[model samples]
Target: MKREIENKSKKKVIIKRQDECLRPSIPQFSVFEIIRATNGKLIAGSDDLSVSGVSTDTRTLSRGNLFIAIRGKNFDGHNFINQAIVKGAQAIIVESDFRFDASQGASRINKDNLSLKDCASVSFIRTDDAIGALCNLAAFHRRRFKIPVVGITGSCGKTTTKEMVADVLSAKFNVLKNKGTFNNSIGVSHTLLGLNKEVDIALVEMGTSNFGEIKRLAEIVAPSIGIITNVGYSHLEFFKTIDSICNEKYDLVKNLKHPFIAILNGDDMRLRKKAKTSKDLNLFTFGLKKTCDFTATNIECARGVLEFSLNKKHRFKINVLGRQNAYNVLAAISCGVIFGLNYKDIKNKLSAFIMPSTRISLKKIRGYHVIDDTYNSNPLSLEYAIQTLSEFDTKGKKVFVMGDMLELGKRSVMLHREIAKKIIKSGIDTLITVGPLSHHAADAIKTKKRSNLKVYSCGCTLEARGILLNLLRDDDLVLVKGSRGMRMEEIIEDL
Candidate 1:
């Protein structure tokens, strides 16, 4: 009887399965069919209909796949349209206003200085909203599956928190989590389209630099449980104010109907107030404060593991760094508790979770400790990373290598300078910075003349790598941090 049910379960996935021959409930449209669907006015006699799947890169283009030529700020996709075709792309999705062929009646410019109208295998579509079309396809694909989706967003800790929640849930559930930072409009759509029907739970992380991004992601996943980790100084450049960012972050809750579960930070006064106006929502909160539903008391961080007592009922231990991560662990525990997992089961599962790559990952290099927190950084996260490093209690001086915290908007100078003061207060002995904004931090640190603190200015990680290698000794501990664009991982490789 169990075997029969298991066999039936395996048939739901749209992707190719080993056991069953299912044609995937999700639609696989040919180039001609998509052109017909979109009413793409081709110049006649274009019959190419090959498609393997959707792709954004020319290098990854496979035979029978429709390559989406998205115009980026730096590069135009129309330039690579021919490359995609040469690499075996059956169809091409191009911008409506894009002039691939300057010649009259030509759909695209070819290497032979001719029109793409002559190519038998290439077909082009002019769409006003290519991203919208992708979103529509992804939404349609997700409707066939009955998966409990969990959407996570916040000013900080969204990725780490999402991973922690997914790991805990995966102990008893077949979980499908979004790949690293794949939480935006295109990223979320791809993640949804990648989902198979057999996945019991879908854990999706939604990130935003500007307004409405979370709304766009939430509409696709429609997560049953929405989690906002905390509101902090992130993406201030896009929104210009904390209130604006708060409003944007709350976009996830705004779209959901009544009877949705919201896991929020009760400690955040702004969020606590916002939770009040949200009607018909079952609100659950986890934090250090006593008012929280899943409060942690008697917290302790020892030997790279955080142990905290949950609501005075159970003591949970998670192998992660910092007190901030302890909050993430508690958030994951609350998720499990809502799903009907007992305290022991939640603790057992959470205990197995390790720190994610590029986010506070610890490695040993010739007996020296290297704390790699170079994943992504904001002012709030940088403080947490600094604090976590200080607690390591190393005999050698504690070192901090930071990079520019992007998207701070008008507050960039103030926040960067403030971090310099924080480095001194945190008792960091050495401070190194990369990029333009971070140079302000390095200057501020030097201005204070706290003889113990050695400040170094490197414009990029390559230059920073030279300083980092020279600073590290046999017993010294180092902490690396920066935003995604800073590429702090390169320095970690050198260390």
Candidate 2:
């Protein structure tokens, strides 16, 4: 199950990961228990009831429990409040200020006094902030269980690294991991709620587009181990600058108070410099640099597998693409090593790591090569995808199918142009840009060379798909990438 919880408060928390985290003894709350927990301060009304599982949606609310009616940007949960009651929700938790003025023509229309069966049993609790209250409850549940957690955050590779770390650690422990990008407030909260008593380890990937998000996630996960993949330009629209991005991403690291194990990319000088302040914690560094604790030397990318020797371990192969992923794999390996896994065991498990969807996924269609890294993109990410595409073995031309990199803010044009220059230098034979912002990149490519290299600038995904289908031959290698908003993965399906 996927869910996220965020704390808007900026307070930093310091804590150690405990061994007894995944105890299966579920926190069973009765209808009366919830009513009593929120009695004096939670709501003005005295109605109290209990149920199973907290829900923000009326459609999914279960019987005999609390239904949190939260107001969102697009939809209001209040509209479905009655539906939740009919669906078996015993109590409702609405925002405290939610008012109904009978004279305003809003209250009498819906008959606000509708009661449930067996006379005034359904309870309604009001809170100033439903989301915050929910987060507090999740944190309370976490402390109650005492689960060991490893929280990971970065501008990129958060999901991939989380999966790798979980997989590597799971080879030994019964691990519970946060699914997908469920690193936000709601996602993190839901992940914690899913935790039963049997889980031995919790691996959560914390992602943030703005400040204070990771900080909130850290409070919920309270990881003893923290991993920061190399930070890059992601969510620039929300952050406005790279420095701000770095500071926001480091929010999780600064909050840890345990014998906190920090795994950092030694290659990223910025990240390395930041690691200095974290010196009080037990630090493990990973990169290709000779000075690092875990370093990869003699890296080679052949076919779809990448072979690299780490700390002189001769035989290590990763199923993912890109030399840049040496950084990602090194982080995962460092985590395994810190957890007391032998070098040989870590090396053997490296081969089991698969690229998550839309991240350098290689496929063969009608003898042509298609590299689908279309999950999302930035100027830096596109450059790495180009490098990976350049290494693919193919009998025919190399094709690049790209979409606009969203959230770049003011630097979108310059960044797009750089992508164009890199593609030209990488010897791409064809370029199909899916959105208008990508015109800058395509124009840059057209300025330098004209050796039968086709640059087609399309207005949208449908047009790009048409161009690619007509232009690609049976033996060409095509790499598709774009921001999440562009939905570039659709093109991959068409191919």
Best by TM-score: 2
| Model 2 agreement with the true structure over 295-382: per-residue lDDT tens digits | 8899999878888887775557889888888888888887776666666777777787778888888888887888988888887788
Q: Each candidate: what lDDT?
A: 0.76, 0.75
Candidate 1: which stretches are off by over 4 Å?
A: 1-27, 30-52, 83-91, 98-124, 446-449
Off by over 4 Å in 2: 1-27, 30-49, 100-115
Number of backbone-clashing residue pairs for each candidate, in the order shown:
3, 20
Q: After superposition, how far is residue 271 of candidate 1 from its true place, in Å?
A: 1.0
Check candidate 1 and list the clashing pairs. Answer: 51-64, 52-64, 52-65
RMSD of 2: 6.1
